[model samples]
Target: MKDTVVEVKSLDQEWARLILEAKKIGLTKEEIRAFLVSTKEL
Candidate 1:
């Protein structure tokens, strides 16, 4: 519904902000992806 769409959009923004912050600290895309994939197994 409308609420779900709004929540997803908010999450997208938060994720974008986190990724930007990670990049600022010199984290590479492959490292980020590997970390995320590892978390999925937990």
Candidate 2:
């Protein structure tokens, strides 16, 4: 819903293997997708 949200701290991405930097880290493909799930207000 419009009220759904993704906290900045919970989201991290690493594209080093596919692009710029050589150092590798951060969330995997599946982990990154967790941010897209629907959520209800607490």
Please count the clashing residue pairs in each candidate, in the order shown: 0, 0
lDDT of 1 at 5: 39
User: What would the per-residue lDDT of candidate 2 be over residues 1-42, giving only the tens digit for each residue?
Assistant: 478786654444433233223224565665444533422222
Query: Model 1, 1-42: lDDT tens per residue?
Result: 354335878888997898888889999999878876887899
What local lDDT score does residue 39 receive in model 2, on the 0 to 100 scale?
Answer: 26
Q: Point to the candidate with the largest TM-score.
A: 1
Q: What C-alpha lDDT, on a 0 to 100 scale, does residue 31 get in candidate 2?
A: 49
Off by over 4 Å in 1: 1-6
**What is each predicted model's overall lDDT from 0 to 1?**
0.83, 0.42
**lDDT at residue 4 of model 2 (Cα atoms):** 72
Candidate 2's C-alpha runs over 4 A off are: 1-25, 38-42
Q: Estimate each model's TM-score.
A: 0.67, 0.25
Number of backbone clashes in candidate 2: 0
